[model samples]
Target: MAISKSQQFFESLWYRKTVWWLWVFWPFHLLLKLIVWLRRSFYRIGIFKSTKLKTPVIVIGNISVGGTGKTPLAIYLIELLTSQGYKPGLISRGYGGHSEHYPLSLTQSTSASESGDEPFLIYRRTKTPVVVDPVRARGAKELEAMGCDIIICDDGLQHYALQRDIEIVVVDGNRQLGNGWLMPFGPLREPKSRLKQADHIIVNGQDMVLEPDPIQAINHHQDAIKEPITAVAAIGNPERFFKTLDGLGYQFKRQSFPDHYQFLKQDFESFSGSILMTEKDAVKCLSFADERFYFLPVSAKLSKPFLQSLMEQIKAITHES
Candidate 1:
């Protein structure tokens, strides 16, 4: 997971490690802003139509790059909807997957290489119907046909093509819209003003906590082997996983890769110690994982007040639909 110099440079820029040079990209950012405005306007004016599904669609996403706890929040919603006797299905863009066909349906046995890590992890964790398609609307339709009463989209805030009943934006509390500029200049994919249009905004690690489950062996069905651990993550924010491990008093060597990096067996061919990774990455490694490999699963712990309000909103939306 060695990062290229260019990637490192952008990381430094996005996190405010360097700032004075930010003005150099201001003009280009302004141009990008104009394009974004035009695109949104097209949708708003019906020039570009958004597909509305029969079931209520709840979109959990972020306006910035990098991880903001969207997947955990989506899983939380799946549990919430189910508890209310609603059958929920999930749809994703399949960011890292390359399946041979469109509208790929996911099951517990679905390969991460085909459905992508997030969708695969969600399916395994929730045991709910999940679909992946570059066309978000088409994916939602597939979920609807699967007998899902409601649909939850993992990350599709900017995907205006698929109309959503609820738009929940998850912001990284630690890096809330770094530099406040869009694209190459900063972390924001859209302007900060977009937050006002969202149905709700959840600051990750604020009202929510990622509670780790027991360590699970990747290639085995028992407890993880006790040994010095080598922590590796290919998530948008590897530091978050590493920090969680540190909080758990785990001392290990850190190895990070770009977000959604497809793992190969050869990547661990030379590793000698017990290796640990996130559940998202574990899905991709299952085909070639060994006994020494382990993964940590985490459940989202949302505040009661937030959950109550969200559930109420969900009920109101679904009732209307």
Candidate 2:
């Protein structure tokens, strides 16, 4: 297969030379923000009204485009809520799915082609009701009908049609609002301070150095479990994966794929030791996975006191509702 220029560009976005190009792209990015501002203004003040589902919906997504570990965080939220006794379901836009108009409920046997990779990944990992549709509210309602008490919108940060109670912004801290600009010109899907809109900001794989380190750069790998081998990822920007691996001090071979990447037999073929895969990747890899393939879980982690207070807020909402 031939490599694409977009693929090559994205892969090398971290280089110092790429940093220089942001200056050239600034004007177009300004236009991008102007367009977003106009579009969101109607939605914000209500000309483009949003509908609410009866169930409380929490949206975990990023302002920047591509994989930023929202799926792992979504799965973690499902398990956390499920364990805490709330019945949770997930709703996603089903990017790359085959169907149109009609929403699909994920089953154990759901393939990536029908449900989209992320929904199938969520369903297989969480065993929570998972629904995928462009009409996010319809999916929420379907999951609600299935007795889900709360719904998690997997990646609906920009999908303004659905109402949400808690909004989480997931970020690759390494990229940190890349070139601090918007699409086609920079990396952000929305503005950076727009993070203030999120109920919480969660950073994944936390070891990006502002100053370069020789030894650290050599071993800046993610899948290699030098510490605990439980790794998990199913997103674009595998550099985030490597950065996380560095933070955990783990050593293992990498099994990275493109954003929304579907698993292949060769991924397993490449890694030999006990595998630690992102919860998102775990879904498709589950059949071939065993005890060795332990999935690591993560969720929104604000300041300690803040998180406790937020939990109380969630509890209050649940009780009052």
Candidate 3:
């Protein structure tokens, strides 16, 4: 499908030609702000009840829009906690899932359209319990009943209704704080200062400039060097993924697709080099992949001190009430 006019219009505002469009979208962004404000108000005054899971809940979210690598990080967290003896569960909004009912557990065979791509992918990769619903609590409560000791919520920074013990904010290192403006006018889903509220700021990609090793790895797999290149990203800001690899001092002539673009074998033949891709893109591509294709999986690395602090926080929460 051709890019929608609104998408093109919203997208163009990120570059040097940003001035006038900011004026065009500022009102819409203001409306988003109003919604956020009211939401905060609801939670602040107890109009909205935020439930704490008996097992700790850690949220991985991006302040801006999509493609901050939330899904990959969730997979990493599941693996980390599982290795450490915690039975972790996952909760998601199921953004693209076609289901209309309350949350349901996801399985390896669940179609992306039924459970949403990211949640399905996480289910398939991690084999941890997975639930997707618009109301995060629906998913959380089910996860708790399913014997999940902890729940790691995906894309949940603004999900104030479901209480979280740890808040992790992920930003595309290249986008930093896109246009540094609010939504519509800029890329922020919430304001930039919300970063201060996060227990951790995970700058996805190599240019991370937070504290020493603000990004760390638990069991992240390294991509085997792809000399020539075959790659794809079905994500917002596909170029950011490509540029991150380039900045890592590894070069691959990567392919960029519109966010969530489906892959076909023909897309791979466009390049002769081995194929590399974000794990999200790999899901659809796998059906069409050959030996040339290798999925490069990356996971967040929490600094040791950060992880220790988070452990303490969880312990304290578990001990209280």
Number of the top-ranking candidate, with lDDT as the measure: 1
Off by over 4 Å in 2: 1-8, 14-21, 205-234, 242-256, 262-306
In model 1, the clashing pairs are none
lDDT of 1 by residue, 260-301 (tens): 888999998877789999999998998889788999999999
Name the lDDT value of residue 6 in candidate 2.
81
Candidate 3 residues 130-169, lDDT tens each?
9998889888999999999888999888889888888988
Which ten residues in a row are the worst by lDDT in model 3?
210-219
Descending-lDDT candidate ranking: 1, 3, 2
Per-model clash counts, in order, read: 0, 15, 2
Model 1 C-alpha lDDT versus the unseen true structure: 0.87
Tell me the tens digit of each residue's lDDT in model 2 across 1-321. 112348547545632335665567778788989988887888879999788877888888888766666776777678878888999989988876667446788876667767777788677667888998889988889998999998899888888889889888877766666666676666777878788878877766442112212221111244423443434455676556566556756666565555555566566664555666554555556445544455553444434554576577679878767
Off by over 4 Å in 1: 1-5, 222-224
Order the numbered candidates by TM-score, best leading: 1, 3, 2
Output the worst ten-in-a-row residue range by lDDT, candidate 1: 1-10
* Model 1 deviation from the true structure expressed as Cα RMSD, one decimal place: 1.9
Estimate TM-scores for all models.
Answer: 0.96, 0.75, 0.80
